[model samples]
Target: MGTINDGNTHPGATLPWGMASALPHTKDFREKANGPAYYNFGDEKIYGFGNVNLSGLGCPVAGAVPLKLSTGKFDWDIENFASTYKDEEAYAGYYKVTLEKHQLVAEMTATTRSTIYNFTPQNDDKQPINLFLDLGANTSHRKGGSLKVVSPQLITGSQLDGAFCGFQKSTNIYFALEINQPNPQVKIYENQKVTDKREVKGDKAGVVWTLDQLDQGKLEVRVGISFVSEKNALDNLRKEQGDLSFEGIHQKAIAEWNKQLQKVDIETSSNDDEQIFYTALYHSLLLPHVISDVNGEYYSREIDKVLVADDYTRYSTYSLWDTYRTLHPLLALLYPKEQRDMVVTMLEMYKEWGWLPKWELFGYDTFVMVGDPAVPVISDTYLKGITDFDTELAIEAMLATAANTKKNPTRPGISQYIEHGYIPIDDRGGDPQKFSWTNGIVWGPVSTTLEYNLADYNIAQLANVLGKNELAKEYYRRSDSYKKLYDPKTTFFRPKLKNGNWMESFNPTDRFFDIRWEGSGGKGFVEGNAWQYNFFVPHAMNDLKSLMGEEVFLSKLNDLFSNGEYDLTNEPDITYPYLFNYVKGHEKKTQQLVREKGDLHFTNTPSGIPGNDDAGTLSAWLVFSQLGFFPDAPGIPTYQLTTPKFEKATIHLDDYVYNGQTIEIIKTGENDRYFNQFTIDGKVREEVYQLSHQELVSTNELVFNTVSERLSEVKE
Candidate 1:
């Protein structure tokens, strides 16, 4: 659990979808192998403040352009530059830290495009105040950067860096920094040595400004960042923060967070539970960031050029492999307008790049994880009634990727899968030995096959809705390819060679990273063992249960947990616990598993999350689980019911989807975790295990009665 509970998340300050995040960085801990913005609760040194970050990614990227303040003689050594800090605090939109060594208190808040820093130096040191612009300290390996002192109070720069997930590419970030007071002297440095130039351009370039006076010992700085250019960065700064006070900007950010957080409110007896729920919600909205500038200008890696948005705000950083499971569905439920715009952004990306994004970061296709995930995301959004995007173009994009055979970068190994029912492990001629490009050769064939089949199922649903009968039939046939790998002898999804025979060697428990993809491997699965991948067929679970037989399926499901085969840390097996809802007389087991796992995995501490939130995928899972139901299938509009964790919970659905309707769920029991039955609008439901999306939103209230034991039947 310790390995999975690393909680590779930063306790930072940022808006709900803000591009800029402010994090407290520890200089000494920088050598450790932590994620992008590492802030452990045990570390004490405050090296500097990071201005940009990407949350939950195992590889280091983003977190570019750090800023540190010092009084007296400037020291470039890492050991001398850090200050021991205490009294650290962080909330949804704000972070505060006290640098005890320097007697300085640093507080930060953020807007969508810019960040505000308020620093107050307590000691009356006669030494001059110096500010260091660390251009080289990016999370990604820095290639080169340039810093130019625009004026006594302003500086502008850009850093070129990349290698996200070890994919060799270049990403650049242009930034503008503004100080409230003017400074007389500014010096430039390259590679840690001071230079006499006003501007420097090269690797590890930085600038330092010596403040004439601290203006009553208070220094305020505002930073704006842009993917396009420095001009846009300054434009964003002026438009968002403008001459506003630090308190004003902080208050506005808080108000925005409150507005979004109020969408779902719960009544709980413990403060820890409330914090865990709201904080999980806060983490869930951090990414799929707002990439477009204030003037609707953005950098498009798909075209390798600059582009402009007409009416919608463009977004980037789609961790689709992890997010398509839970985060996007959660968005469709709570933030329908935003989800529609996100789908529009995906369609536009296809128009610009030739294919949809797999694991995108900073406008580049990272190819980080497996699967054709965008299929389920768009299909789920359309089925949920957020159909404001171009449906025809979206369908074309889905088909283009689905039928691709020439080693397309987006849908790797589609050609092989089309020829044979499953992706053969021996079809590894074009597999990438290095993670440099997105040429789309199948790396993990077994996992890719299962994921593509699931995606095909979702695409078939969309095709059926659009009246494309032949296309729907073809995709529906392809969606059943998962059965080809099923071996009744073992009742598991086994890997096969191209010669229509199972691999000679077999070990369902073996797991490792024999390939570039993360997680266990060796038996043809990606990041999971055969035991976990056995239940990958979420679209046709009933058929799977029939194939495995009800008694065997139930026993295996229970053994998965008791024998420690169930992995809650990863996404592939997160839904395994909920499959019991599909079996009659076993729904109570679903409630028991959901409640037990929720308590064991999530907490209120900094290291609370079970795994890399994976761009809020795990957090969204917790959110949905706590809400008393889960969107068990991505493209389906139904939710599998479970027992609520709270006494009362309310969800304020987006007006665009449900006419601003609010669904309140009330649970009545005395410490009882089993579900007895449920009623909607005073009418009892025949099937208490599931609820359709229409039924959930159209009604006003839902009441769940509980007892010490599970009820055999519903009573009117």
Candidate 2:
């Protein structure tokens, strides 16, 4: 997992929903040895530390503000400042490393928007302790930036970022740094020149502070991060970490992590399985970061102005196309309050940008993926009873995005979709490639049709919740449009032209059968073949069963596993294992497949994750599967049940949004591949395959008596 193209996640020392993630700045600062992610686990030489790098994302954006504590030297080159270190340690909200070259120890901990550093020189020698701030050493390409020396102990600056996958350029980050040393000498470098001015502007500048006197050879520093202005950065630093020592900040960060991690408690005998589960849990909590400061002031790229979040937190960095499937659902379930803010954040974006983000990064919609995913995420969150946002505005935004038939940013080729119920393979109406998302021609029309169906059904659900039955019916019909693409001859969802004719060549297994959208291969399906993407009509699975025949549906579902087409690295077919429950007498297959896939793909190693976690989509799959249920159908408010890995696992529930304080999922007989019976508080359930949202969270005890699949039959 090198932070690009696949499931390589870096170690992030950021709290849940924290903006500043302190990571090791390895020697790869010269290039993207690991994309925009700063840490390279295999690299022995670390230059310093950086903040605001993302973890487990398919594409990288910013790895900004690299700083190091060096002594007896002042060089602008990264090689001069780079040092080989050993005994590296990393955890949630905390990172520690020993620099062998500089003979110093560096430890970092973070608040929501700040980083506190503690540096101790191993050999003082009475030499001046040099603090190096490399404003030009970003892993992403440099644009332009500015820096100002506020005083001997403080400095404020900002750097231009946002080249996410060669698209979008508005993720500029600002920072304010404060050191504990009093009356220190400052040396500024601009384009490799030791400048005499107190201000430096450009991408080729760095600042060095030489201090001969320190409090017992210990250097303490705090950095506040902001996306709006430098004043907000300094204000964030002053209020957030006021009077907190290095040790105090480190302990507070650990305590914050514990508070979030303790929301779920599990009883498992396998330490490896437990470690993997918690690691996944930690990763799941790292995204959709809060970008607003304590004063609620943030820059809105949609409006090109700084606005204050009056009653809620403003968040950015939404990988919606990837996280909409399961991550948003998980957040809605466990973190409803925060999820409500996120929904409001999207709604605010709509009010200003006139469209929901396809893949929003740092307040800008990159249009990185196909379809309107924000519909499912926001609709799903609202449908789950998290109604703290504007309802009328939400409905208006969804209707606008869904009904737009011309030059839509979220949904391209929408007019073709409306006229024919499905987009044609040859329709090239919208921008061929908006921004830098490499969608050739019409941008995966077959897949976009399916994606729009899911999104439309989610909006229909939202509409139904508001007693708008007629409006719900309209979207429901739109949702069933995926049925038009089903090829009876091939028994798969094939690409059809505008005139109701199939494409001349149909190869279901050819990954790159047609054009590509960015790195997501395949023409008809983004990053998937027909065998993987054809089962995407979760909203109309009954219709799919009728169209493909129940036997064909089951056979094709089984073929995914038998032919190795069940890609856990991607999202299209991740829910196929749970789809067995939709068919009769196939519940045991779901149980076995879910457990096997979880154990096989998810482990306690660096490569334990099978693919791009896609902003914790796969990790949320593991968390849900290991805890014994999954939100298989997006925006449906239903969870498909499977075998539980733990004997007893308790999940904290929202008292206001849900009916219970805690819900326990207990597996009684054994941790095995199959289960024989399912009950809620000793009462047998007629429908053992799934549970409604109200029914699942309100229940106190949901038990699954499992057994080994020594018996491999579909039913007992």
Candidate 3:
């Protein structure tokens, strides 16, 4: 269709050495619009969304059907011509499609590393190919340039030596199609000023040859991708293909999906939801990509201002602030082995870099967001009973990072939080700064307070569990440090002055700026203001109620839910929806809010995320809600229940259940997303929430019911 190859000067791509026999797979069994239902063969999963660009879903057209090349390649014409086959019960990562226009049979395979598409065109009018390589189809950091075309015949005869650089400047990546047979009539189509082609039959494709042809239909093109240079792309093509045809590789990829889909048996009547969930889960696991040398050596710039030996794979591009809540937790549960390895990697990173990372990017610990969320990630793993490593060493490293470093972008507020119980609206360390003028300072004090408190609570709980009483006591005391920030006068924790005087003109919602890191939303705190931050004291909810009084706490909770202001589209109020679980007789509200928030906020789109997916934050909420539970706090070993989306689902843990029991949740007649009661194996329970990881691991069957409460009765 369309061909653009700069020139052949670069060396060949290297083969991927980390290849494992562990095939790629998925638990989802639903089908979608375009491709075969879904296929996870080896390291890939394929979805068929005929013409819709679901940002980052990585549609399955790459392998089966050649990329559609056009003059203005920015727009995809596939949308006008076809629709992906949509079936609900189809298994994960496997899809079969019959093209609407050409009736071409196509199936796709998606894995962690590769995508394969197989198409059999029936009425071939010269296959009328539209293969376009839009070099700009990548992340924001990508730079496009020309690619080299090296086949067996061209590489040996011409004898070009050095690296044949790409046509466009700054084009760091390249592609080469390992074809089945040498076609005589190969010419670069629609290319201006560059029309060239050479045959390479027996010898392997090397850098000496030039890529200047658009073979529309004659030969089958094997398209392999890599982040490394073109030489490596060729190298990968050789190692992966060698003598195997493109169809051979496609078949191998399909087999990989079949194996992984066999992991968990999903038995749901609604095939559509099941398909969406499994594919969503599959896409969720695809990113935070690994960019490294062929030998798997990645760039590591630990906090020590020096390079260190990076033995374990270093993953980058995570939004930890959002992911820490649910994504990380979900990984620890479903993929424990992967989770353990990731934890080990974090520990090694801590050793190399002094502080544990909050948000680690490529070779740099870019602390983009507030919160020592690393604590929760590790602690959630430990509390959820996935402790397989050196717990003491992990804690030691965690403590060092939290204690050794005190300041970040919002250090002023964090330091004050550690020193004065609450961050003061007025400057205590020095003269008032510009940000001190804002109101967000009301919530700005939360980052360190919550971080240290959670770290302390987790470490203490872990220490006591591990028989280290002294360490436990020390951390337990540290956990209580939040008491210093609680102001009794307003019945709400407010920022204080250096001399413990309340700041003048203290309106929680009035002032806008905060001196805290990034001003959260204005200066007092992170993305949310006081209304959202008030419910953050996860362990001290009872204490918070004591200050506001039961009536006030209930009223505040009521106001938060009804006030369109408590947006579920953001992360600040994540725990707020579940606060009703803390209040006695208010469990129904918790159920209603959790389901509403879960259902309304999630959509399959580029804008699906209200905030950063942050590595799995939103996914975690889905997994927990669907399972009928969520961890309210890190160290606190309990989960609150929301209405479940499924009637029954089985969670597979490594070693928790004696043949895991089926968790069944019954929905109320009114489509209102709230719950009325919970049952342990059909017996009604007193509490409104579900079991935490600890409880779930230790307990048996769980079932839940819900009812809608009248506004009058709710107040009463």
Taking the tens digit of each residue's C-alpha lDDT, what string does model 1 give over 1-716? 11135666777889987888888776432333245545556676877887777677667776667787777777766655578888887877899988887678999999998898988877676567777887766666655688777887898888776877768777789899988775546778887788877788876678877775777568888999899999999999999987788999999998999999899999988999998898888878987999999999999975789999889988888999899999999999988887887888888888988888888888878777788999899999988888888989998888778887775877777778989988988884464565334665566677889999999999989989989999889988998988899898887888889999998677887786456655546468877888888888988889889888988788888888888989887888889878888888888888888988999888776668887788888889989999888888888888999889889999998789679998999998654587767999889899998998878888889888886544533211
Best by TM-score: 1
RMSD of each: 2.6, 2.3, 10.4
lDDT at position 126, candidate 1: 56
Tell me the whole-model lDDT of each prediction, alpha carbons only: 0.82, 0.80, 0.47
- Predictions ranked by lDDT, top down? 1, 2, 3
lDDT per residue (tens digit) for residues 175-254 in model 2: 99888887788888887688988888776777888888786568888899999999999898888899888778888999
Count of residue pairs whose backbone atoms collide, per candidate: 3, 3, 81
Runs of candidate 2 exceeding 4 Å displacement: 1-6, 31-34, 125-128, 430-441, 513-519, 708-716
Candidate 2: the clashing residue pairs are 1-8, 7-611, 7-612
Alpha-carbon shift of residue 157 in model 2 (angstroms): 0.9
How does model 3 fare in lDDT?
A: 0.47
TM-score of model 3 vs. true structure: 0.69
User: Candidate 1, which segments miss by more than 4 Å at Cα?
Assistant: 1-4, 27-34, 431-440, 517-519, 709-716
Worst 10 residues of 1 by lDDT: 27-36
Q: Pick the candidate with the highest lDDT.
A: 1
Better of 2 and 3 by lDDT: 2
User: Mind sharing the TM-score for model 1?
Assistant: 0.96
